[model samples]
Structure formats: structure tokens, C-alpha cells
Target: MLPVDAMITNQEKLNSLATECAFHRFSIAEIQAATRNFHNDLVIGKGGFGKVYKGRINGTRDTTRRIVAIKRLDSFSMQGAAEFMTEIEMLTKVRHSNLVSLIGYYFDDNEMILVYEYITNGTIEHHLRKADAPLSWMHRLKISIGAAEGLNYLHTGVGNQQGVVHRDVKSSNILLDENWVAKIADFGLSKFIDQQTSGVSTRLKGTFGYLDPEYYMTGRLTRKSDVYSFGVVLFELLTGRRAVDTSFREEEWNLAKWAEKCVKERRLDQIIDSHIKAQISPKCLKEFVQIATRCLKSCRKKRPTMAGVVLALQQSMALQEQYDSSPQSASFTHIVQHLFSGSRLNSVVSTSASAPVTPIPHRFSSPPVTPSPHRFSMSPKLDKIDPVHLTLNLVARATQNFSPSLKLGEGGFGTVYKAELPEGQLFAVKRAKKEHFEALRSEFRSEVKLLAKIDHRNLMKLLGSIDNGNEHLIITEYVPNGTLRGHLDGAHGSVLDFCQRLEICIDIAHGLTYLHIYAEKKIIHGDIKSSNILLTERFRAKVSDFGFARLGDAETDGAQVVNKVRGTLGYLDPEYMRTHQLTPKIDVYSFGVLLIEILTGRRPIQSKRSPDEKVTLRWAFGKYIEGDIMDLVDPQMKESLDIEIIEKIFELAFQCAAPTRADRPDMKVVGEQLWAIRMDYIRNGRRG
Candidate 1:
């Protein structure tokens, strides 16, 4: 039996915690106002305690709307005031980026509601089982890592040193943000631990199929229970199956048990989700499966600590990086060492299956392309209104009549200058020619209407437009950070870490998904490049400059657009450029170029190599086909890169730049693919 830390139940400790922390206590009216009076339409989640509603409140700098998710507890549920107070007490004392923030709470007249920062993507369970868009392997891994980080916080007494056990650590409790970053949520079942202790003895309570054997049978609850449940989550991610699925065969009903058997037999590929099969590196998968095996051991002592598990996961991801980086020799299996603590695969399985499966050689032997994924248009549309019109005089005062000092940049459209309003507010103002401005003027209202219809956090927010017959001016929120082009331009070309670039790519994909599938109108962003992609204060990627966007409907587009060719030289789609027919694939093709820029930190057009021909597209293509993808990657950034993920991104970029439109994935699949690629490092808690 594993050693146990005595559970402490000091009432004074609880009272002291309540007194020490300051929590937002909202009135009934405020709760109703935020949730539209607990409207069913706003419900985003349903748990045993009660329903969760998504609501917008007035907290923006200028009284604009800020969304928050509110969880209301049912008065009659077993998880009542005790659980509610426990959650608030625990959350108020601890804070980590990976842990969900309890912004505020309400407790008046027997009504209890807890408010948290809205996580846009919803829970891990939704993406794993319910949502049509199946999460790629990397995404699943990101969720695992994020959840582990949160768990480690509690186990290691991070911040307020409130060593706490979530008590209920499962996929449903893991929430994801717009960038696919994971957060641990729902602390209703949590229990506090002594700072120096390993764990505590408690009642046997947890989801089935994930319960620690010792905890359930002997009632000796330890932090290992959480590890056991996390192991189950790893099982689900690997198999794309549930913790307990009645539909599964008897021997495979419990995913942890079945996975244990499969890992020992080396039949991993056969059980992998077909959708993400090609994405997993064989060595990476083995290491990950081995970690899961350790976590799921029947003997509590055999399971690694959450901290150890976190390191193991990171090492697994690092192993994949190693394999992807060394391609010349093609010997991957021999290089991977049994690095994680407590080699658990050999011990977990009582007997290997009679028919042992073939030991998969390495990821290099796997097929190149991921299978077409299900669409991810389940994203909610953001809100917007007609531009906040500004007068010509106000623009002139802010820009000093287009002075060079305030100039932001110059481009094909016109010159952009930084401007300040009467209220000392900053804005980006663009200036253009009368003829070109007139074209914009004619399409201003309709285009603004379409643009206004687009509402996504990943897309640049349109402030307003101005066209007074003599001149044309447009205003937009000044993106504090410069364009992606500016960030990737330099000799070093490694300002952004691997994680930041991955998130930027995912952000661009999300913006494209919103425009093509979620927006009211299926709009085609004619120009998709690093210059048009803007970054925010937090390094969030926002697709900007819809000046070249093309609107489409069944009657007009016939699912495609036709127009005079217009786009950057190197980013143009060969098919669209040749056929003079516009389609969403144009954006996909350009996005492929953007991916290339991100991977290699090279401009679309490299005109000189000491006045001789430098690198050519044909040469790059040949390198990719010859299995030397590392050659195209920016050498400066290679040291910190995830070779497996970079290879996958390269493959996706190749698919996007396919000569035929059908060969290229739509923006929906593109977004999913990019997000998955970014998630590779996210799950391991390392970007660079």
C-alpha cells in the first residue's frame, strides 16, 4: 500500500482562508443582467451541479462588452453550498494561466453562481467526442499538457501554496481557449492538502474507468488518483475512444486496460484514430504510450508524480523533435532512450497478446498526408457594428496632414499613418488615390456590411471608413505589434519562439475559418500573406486588410469566383492565376506561402544571391520531395524547433499549395491542420 498523508480538517484554516481572500460578490440583478436572466439560449455547458451560461458584461475600456461564462449551481443538487464555497475559497487562493480564473461569484438568497473568464473553444470532451471537428493528435496532447500543468500547480503548491487536489481530473474538466490553449476548470470537488505531504486519505469518489484501484478498493485517496485519471485521458487521446465505452468490445470496454495490453503488444498503430494516424511519430507515440502506462499502474507507488509526468510528456515531444531533425541516417528507433522515470510498459501488462503486432519502425515510414478532417465551423460569430465614422478634419489633426513622422508603413494600397483623435485615442489611417479610392467608395457600404458581418477575435476589428468625394480614408484599430512580415525580417529571424509562431499560424487559420464558413457571407480574402496578418499586444494573430475580399453566394460564385487576377507575385495560386477564376483555394494557396515564410523566415521573392540567382521554388520543392525538409527550415530557428511538427506543417503547406484546388484542403481543414501543428508543443508545455 502507498503511504498516505493524514487529511487535515481544521475549521479555523477554512475560516482564515475565507477571511484572507477578496472575492467579487455579485448581486442577483448583476447575475441576471450578465446572463440575460439565466436564458436557456446562452447555455454553453451542463454539469451535474447546474448549467453554465455565456454572457457579455460591461467592463471594456469604453463600456464595450466583455464576455464571461457563468456557472449556476442547482439549489437541490448534492453538490450544494459546501462545494460552492469550497470552489470559491480554493480559486481565490491560487492562480495560474493554465488554471481557470474565477473572476467573481454570487451568493444571495440561496442562489449561487460562479463566473469565470470565458474559454472560447469549450471543454476537451466537446472537441474529443461531440464536436464534428476532431482534434488532431497534437491538440489532444496540448490539452493533456495544459491539464497536467494545472494539476502540478495544485500538487506542488504553486502561488498561494494551497496544495489542493482537483478530486475530479477528467477531460470534461479541461477547457480550451481560442488559441487551443488548455485550462483546468471545475474545482467543486477539490480538496486541500498539506504543503509538504504526498496526498491525503479521503472518500472514494471519481468518474468510472479513471478511478485509482487502491482509492476505490481501500479508500486511500492520494494525488496518484489524479495521475490514474490523467492516464485514462491519455488513453482516450491515443485511441480516440472514451474512458468507458459500452460500445467497445468487452476486453476493450475500459480504455486504460485495453491500452495497457496494446502498448505491450506494440499494436499501437492498429488502435490509433484513423483521422490522426499519419500525424503521430512512431517514436513519439511509443514514448507517450509508455508514459500513460506508468500513470495507470495499479500500484499507486508505481505512478509518477504530476511533475514527473509533465517532464515525461515534454521528453516525449522532444523525442519526436529529435527524430524529425535527424533524417540523413534514417535510423530513428535506436536513438530514443528509455528516459522517463519508472519504465512502466513491461510491468503493467500481465501477459502479451498471443499475436504480437509488428514493431512500427519510425514516423518517416508513415504516409505523408493526414486524412481529410471534419469541418470546425461550430465557432460562434463575434459581434460588430457599422464603422465609427470620423471627420476629415479629425484625421488631418491626428496625422499632421500625412507627416512622415507619424507614418506607419507604405504598401500597394496606399500609405498608412498613425493618428490620434481628440480624445487622445490612437488609430491607423490609410490614404489612397481618387480612382482606387472611388472603387473603394462604391463598394464601401456593401463591403463594410460584409466586413461588419464578420466578427472573430482572430480577425482585425474595423473601426470605420471615410470617403468625402475628394479623398478616401479608412481607419482601423492600431495593432500595437507590427505585421508578421516585420517580425520575421532580419538576419537572425528568430525573434518569435516556436510556440509563438505556432499560435500565430493557428490564429491566422482561425481567422480564415471564420471568414469562409462561419461569417454570414462566404467571403474570400483575396490576399493572404504575412504583411496583411497583424499582431496584437498579446502577440495574437489577427487577419487584417479585407480591401481585396471577394463576396460570394450560390447564384454568383457557383461555389467559385471569377475576376481579373490580383495578388502578390509569389503567394498567388497557380490555378487561380492561370485560370482567372477565383476560389477559396486562392487563400489556401497563399496561406501555404505564408507557412513557408514562417518555417524558413524567407520572403516570397528572393531576387538576389550576390546578384546571381538565389533559392528557387523548384529547388525547394525538390528538397521536400527528396525527404530533406529540414533544408528548407530557417537554420537559426532549427535549434528550438519541433522537427515532427515542422514536418507536418511542411506537409500541410505542400497540400495547400497543390496544383489542383481539390488537392488543397478548404480553409476549415486548413485551420484544423494548423491548430494541430501548433498544439504539438502546447501539450508538452514547451514552444521553443
Candidate 2:
């Protein structure tokens, strides 16, 4: 017999081994009884590897239900004792927040039984398939971030041993927990590579849709190969479509090919899930397309690293913040006018009471307000009614009691309320707070005068305003969907598809263009951030909140004045903050920061592990430029994003966030590039 201590140590090792192998030492009779002799009713799910069954594990005094996904190793199958050993070793050492935990197992005679934690929320593939309960863009982003973070840990986690790579990383392999958090599963095809042999070649192993094409052709596996597979997952997440659909026959069976074709023909809209269409911002859609295209590129070297992918998603969220802070540009002004040109604005203005005249000297005889021809219809009599009274009662009834439920949201200015008219029209009523009544008065007058003169789709419309006693309210068309910040914070859904994110950036740029150039008085949006940009049901963006907006003039204070710094923390322009010099480029710099957020999925001020680690995106851009783009993306998004689009977005963000404002592209150029990219997808039949 052995010494007592040695004997105990050996027993402990045995127990550990048993746990790793999932061996419970269940008697044949007990298993059969629990499973009801493997009855069909007990069957839960089936996969290529094995069948799953729901059963009960019983003790002398109690019984508890347990779900076990059983994978029986055929005696004669190619995957024998060696593969089993490899799997046991891997599963034993790997544990993470987003990795499925292993449970007990059994081994007797020629049979082998393995158990795992039961994930009740089902598989990622299930959510992608369900039509009625579709996953929102925000949820998708969150999932992508979590999954990617887990994979990142696995790929470069701590150990004396080599890094491990999960050869299979499709949607089916991603399991969802109770809260819908994604946990990567199915590591049967995993391989461990010592850093010393980092460049070694191996046999290609993975499902077709998610396999890295380079690994298949060259037989060389690198971390970048995982990046390629992740791109496919991103495409699936964005489109809510499958990787491989046999129903499409020989030509359209391939998802990549089909998507590429659609992109080329500007018909990508046809390929996306209808449920996701209304929920995703056009900016996000454009970014998704760009990212997906890059991920599927023929060359693997051009792909973004997993870190880069994460950064891209974070960057998308940042862009929303920037948009909220900035004022509407000229292009947006044009679009808004065009959208309501035919009737709405004209009907309101033309039917209003005649303008009150003020005597002026002959030298200054010009009219105070010159209504555009597009502002009203040709009908002379229709313009006779007073427009002010037409909307006064509507505003009064909407703000009745100022019910809490109908209150839309609150901001620096005051609370907003949602009002419904007898005609079923919805409007957003922004009520000024008592403390800020004076500022509110100024803003109300400024907005009324300015909006009345300018028209654009990207600019928020001023439907009307009310100044009654101490209560002041500004009414505008109601946007059902909330602010961009809501979506970024995971309120709306997971990650915004890359394409849609890009489109949102472009939309903001267009609005900025209109304000900077097209408007009668060139104006500057003082603050640009996600919370201030509003979205519509169709995911179209409209720049809102112009209370801090100012016009450029010779008598204006110095561009770099010593004044209080006002704007969101992460998106503030470094130059503006330090020197207090404000310029149109200040908005550009903020937009650049937003671009970085879109690319990295990281906040501008994320804390690093060490006190010295730089968390700002500006400091982190170098890592991405060095081909570590994957490090920047939200881990939840790593599994499903396209590497190419990530890289492209990174490039754009880099340009936008350049240290010097002079190096950045103007909003018009940025808008044009985004529009061109969207058009490219449209022309290629990639977007429907």
C-alpha cells in the first residue's frame, strides 16, 4: 500500500480526471431508467456528431432533471481515443465568462459519455432563424462583443502552454445563456499551437461556411484564419441570413456569392432579414456591408485582426455620440426641405396670419423673412388662413397635464413629451425647465427663425413652438425610434451592422454640410454625441438639439477663447478642450473620434490593465495601424464581423481622427464617400 498522503493525492487526481471526462459512474440500469430506454419523447436536439436527450439524475432520496447532449463515439470512427484525449485536455483548462462550462461524464466498456452545462436559451443559430422575435441590432452588437472577447481570451490567454484555436466557430457553436449572453461551444476541432511554432502549417478543419479559405488552400493556420471565419459570422449577424442555403440551387446556394452579387447590384436590401431592416440605421447597414466585403476578400493578408474587428464595432457606437453633438449640415437641410416641401411646411406657413410689418428706412428696405418658393404651394387662397391658430390648439391638447407616460425623454434643455392629435399625428414637445426659461426662450426664438428659413431632411424640423406664461415648449415631428445613444447602450439591440453604421455617419456628415455651407447663416453644432442624434422608424438620422449652436461671424469671439468646455467627454476635440478655439474643424475632430469608436467598439477612455496603459482610442490607433485591428473591436462582435470592412472603416476613422484637423476630410466629402459606398452595395446587388 502507498503512504496516506500519496494515496489521497492520487485519489484527488482521479476525481479531477473523472470530472474532466464527465464520468459519473452511472450504472447501465440507472441510465436506461432515467432516459426511459432512450425514448423519442426524451430526445431534445440532434447534430452531425450526436443526439441530445433530457433525463433525470436520481440519488437515494431525491431526483433532479438534467439535460445531456450525448455524442457517442463509434467504435470504428476515425475520431478515436486520441481525439477524445485532446478534447478532454482542452476543456479541462479552458474556462471563461463566455465559454460553455463542462460537467460530469461516464466511461464504461466500449461507451463514452460526456456532460455539459445546459444552456436553456438555445443556440445563436436559433435567434438568427426566428422571424417574429428577431434579434435587434443592439443585441447583435452585444453578442458579437461578448463572443469575440471570449475567443480573444482563448486565442491569446495565459498559460505555460500554447494558445488554442477553435477550428469550428459558426453560429451553431455559439450557445446563449439565460440572459442571451453568447458562450462559444463545440471545441472538438480545436488545436493548440506553441508560440515557438506559431507559423506551423496544419490540416484544414472546419465547417464550410465558416472555414477560412486561406487555411483550406494553403494548409497554414494563423490567428488571422480565425479572423476570416469571424467575418462570415458578422455577415450572418447583420443580414440575419444563413451562411449556406441549399434552397437557392447551384448558383445562389453560396451566401458569400449571393451577398456579393446583391452588393454589386445595389440590392442588398433583398438579402437582409425584413425584421432587421426597419430596426437598423442606414449608416450601420453601410458599415456592415463594407466590413463584410473586407472579411470575404480573397486575400487573407488584407483582413483585419480580431482586435481590429472589435474596435470597429466600438467605433460605430462612438459615431452616434458625435452626431448627437453636431448641428445639421447643408445636405441635410436640402433633404429635409425636399421631404416636406410639397405640403407640410407650406400648409402650416401659408395658412398662418399675415406677417406683422416694422417700418424700415429706404436704405434697408429688404424683407426680414424671404419665404422660399418651395416653402408654399401656388394656391393663393389657401395661404389666407392664419397658420399660428391652426397648430395652437393641437399643441395645447398634447401638453394637457403633461402626463408622465407620454413624456418622451429629458436633456440639458428640459423634458420632452409625446403628443397625439385628433388626426392621429404624433409630435415631440420639448418643454423648457423653469430654471432655464431665459435660455429656452432664446433657443425657441432662434430655432423658429432659423428653421423657418432653412429646409433639409437631415436637420430636425421645427413644427411649431409655444410661449404661454412660465411654460415654454418646442414641437417637432415625433421620431418613434429614440436617440442613437439608446441603441449604442444595448437598449435597441446588439451591434449595428457595419454598413448601417457607416450610413449613419454619412447622414450626420450631410446634415453638417448643410449647416456649414448651405444654410443662410453658416452655423456650428457646439456638441456632437450619440444622445443628440435621433433616428426614425426607417433608421434614417436627423440632427437635433441646436440650443448651443452658434453662427460664425467676424465679430465672434476668438476661435480659441478661454471658456468653459462643453461636450461629451469621449468625443470632445482635444484642440478645443486645451485652447478653447472653436472652429468647424472642431466638429470634424469630434466626428473622427466617433469614427474610431465605430471601428474599435471601445470607449474613448477605457482603462487599461496597468495604470500606464493608454485607454483613449487616439492612443490605441497605432496598434490597429500595425495590423492588430481585431484588438479594437468589441469581443461580442469578433465572431460575426467582416475583416475587410473593419479595415476600411479603420482607415476612415484614422483619417477622421488624425492628430491635425487639417488632415481630416470635410463633412461633404465624408458624406459623399459613404453615399458612394452605399451606392456600390446597391449597384452590386448586395443591398436590397
Best by lDDT: 1
Per-candidate TM-scores read 0.46, 0.47
**Residue 232 in model 2: shift from native, Å?**
1.7
- The total number of steric clashes, by the backbone 3 Å criterion, in model 1 comes to 1
Candidate 2 on 595-674: residue-level lDDT in tens? 66655555555444342223445445545534565676756443455454556566566556544455466777777656
Tens digit of lDDT per residue, candidate 1, span 573-601?
65664466777778988898788788887
Query: In candidate 1, where is summed lDDT lowest over 10 consecutive residues?
Result: 346-355
lDDT per prediction? 0.68, 0.62
Global Cα lDDT for candidate 1: 0.68
